[model samples]
Each structure stands twice: as structure tokens, then as C-alpha cells.
Target: MNIEEYRLYCLSKKGVTESIPFSKLPNVLVFKVKGKMFTATDINTFDSFSIKCEPETIEELRLQYDALEEPPYFSKKHWSRVVVDGSISDKILYEWLDISYRLVVAKLTKKERLELEHL
Candidate 1:
């Protein structure tokens, strides 16, 4: 999928907001709330895209989705960095992104939850 498609998909999720938190990569679009980041990508290039995933399902996803285990940047056991190049279908990619958005939203604080409810 393209950068605009990804941005719209994430924004469609409740409470999620897009920003550029990483100064190093001005083109990198970071999706977050309060302060936590759930997804991010470099709109200028499709080198990498990050998304949150369940710790237990990480390995399974890596096997099922052809994802790689890249840690330090992500939880290694939870989050994943899926390289973009048209290898995967847009439908499946959006589905995974929705899952990541929900997972991140679930961890929001009570105040944050209320704030998001208004949005």
C-alpha cells in the first residue's frame, strides 16, 4: 500500500493521531496517542513500516505473514517491522494494522480512553 492509504487507514481507527515524532526522519509518519506510538512509516520511501503485535502471536505471524524478527526497534516478541514492496495484499495489511491499533488503544489510560471516546 502507499503512504496516503496507510495514513488514512490508521486515522480511521479511533483515537489515533498522526505525527512526526522522530526528527531524524522528517518523512517518517508516526501514529500515536498521548505519547505511545502504535504505528509508523517513512512516507518518502517504503523501506520499513512498524506495527504493534501480540507477543504470543509474533512468531506465528512471522511464519504466517512472512514477517521478520527485528528487535531493539520493536519488542522483537510483539511488534514487527514489515518491509513494503507489494509482496502482501492491501486487505491483509489493513487487517493487521487494525489489530495493532486496537491492541494499542486497549492499553490506553482511563483518561486517555475518555479523551479518545470524544474523538
Candidate 2:
């Protein structure tokens, strides 16, 4: 899918906020839930995005999908870079994005989660 599609999908999640926190890379848009980043992509290129993934299943996912790759600047074990080259379906892309969001939300502090629940 394209950048606008990606942005709208991410924003559709509860409590998600978009920001360009990096001054040096202003085009890199980060999507976060309750201030914790879940995924990010370069708006200028719209080529790929980095997302958090389950470490236990990450390698298997990489092996299963050619579009999945090591992220440029994130922990190789916990994050994946998914190339948006039309090699994968939009449904799979949305599923991966949902997983990333849920993983981050799962790690939120009790109070933070409660805050999110109320939001």
C-alpha cells in the first residue's frame, strides 16, 4: 500500500499518534501509542517501514516473506523492515502493523494501559 494508506491505517488504531521526532530526518514519520513507538516510515520515499515484531517469530517471518528484512536502525532481533514494493498483499501489511501496535501496547505500564483504555 501507499504512504497515505499506511498513515491512515496506523492512525485508525486506538491512541496512536504520528510525529516526525527526528530533526535530521524530518520525513521519517513515527507512529506511536501512548508515546511508545510501534512503527515508522520515511514519507519521502514510501519504500519501506520499520516495525516491532515478536523475536521468537521474527526469523520465521523473514524466511517466509521476501519483503521482510533487517531494519536499518532498529534492533535486528525485535524490529523488521518491510519493503513496500507490492510483493505482499495489503491485508498482510495491515496484520503486521496490527501486531506491532499490540506488541507495544502489551508492554505498557499498568497505569499507562489504563489511561489508554480510557482514551
Candidate 3:
């Protein structure tokens, strides 16, 4: 999918807020919920999107998908860069995004989760 489609899908998630956390990179869009980031990518050039992932599952994910790779900017153990090439199915990308969102939410404190629920 293209950048607009991807952006819309990411924003559609409940309590998700889009922001550019760094003033130096205004084109980068960080998607977060309850102040915790789940995914992020450059809006100006939709080359890839990085998602927070389970450390144990990263290797398997890299082997399973040709379009996924280690992100240059994120910790290799906790994030995977998913290329926007047409080779990967859009459904799979969305699924991964959902997984990332859930993973971040799962780490939140009970009070944070309760706050997120109301958002």
C-alpha cells in the first residue's frame, strides 16, 4: 500500500496519535497510544515502516518475509523495518501493525491501560 493508505490505517486504531517527535525530522510520523510508540516511518518517503516487536520473534519474522529487515535507527532486538515494496501483502503489514500496537499496549501499566480505554 501507499503512504496515505498506510497513514490512514495506522491512525484508525483506537487511541492512536500521530506525531513527529523530533523537530529535526518533521517528516517522520510516530504512531502512539497512551504515550507509547508502536510504529513510525517517514511520511515524505515511504520506504519502510518500523514496528516495535517481540525480541524472540524478530529472527523468525526476518526469515519469513523478504520485505522485512533490521531497522537502521531502532534496536535490532525490539524492532523490525518492514519495507513498502509491493512484494509484501498489505494484509500482512496491517496484521503486523496490529501486533505491534498490542505489544506496546501489553506493556503499559494497569492505570495507563484504563486511561487508554477511555481515549
For 1-119, candidate 3 gives per-residue lDDT tens digits of 88888889988988899999989988989999888999999988899999988898899989989889999988999999999988889888899999999999999999988987887
Output the number of the TM-score-best candidate.
2
Q: All models: lDDT?
A: 0.79, 0.96, 0.91
- The TM-score obtained by model 3 is 0.93
Candidate 3 RMSD computed on C-alpha atoms after optimal superposition onto the true structure: 1.1
Query: Which residue pairs in model 2 clash with each other?
Result: none
Error of 3 at 84 (Å): 0.4
Tens digit of per-residue lDDT, candidate 1, span 1-116: 88778888888877677888778778878998656788888788866688888887788778876644464466677788887767778887887788787788789888888888
Residue 108 in candidate 1 has what lDDT?
Answer: 87
**Which is the leading candidate under lDDT?**
2
**lDDT string, candidate 2, 1-119, tens digits:** 89999999999988999999999999999999999999999999999999999999999999999999999899999999999999999999999999999999999999989988887
Q: How many clashes (backbone atoms < 3 Å, residues ≥3 apart in a chain or on different chains) does model 3 have?
A: 0
Model 2, CA-based lDDT = 0.96
TM-score of each: 0.86, 0.97, 0.93
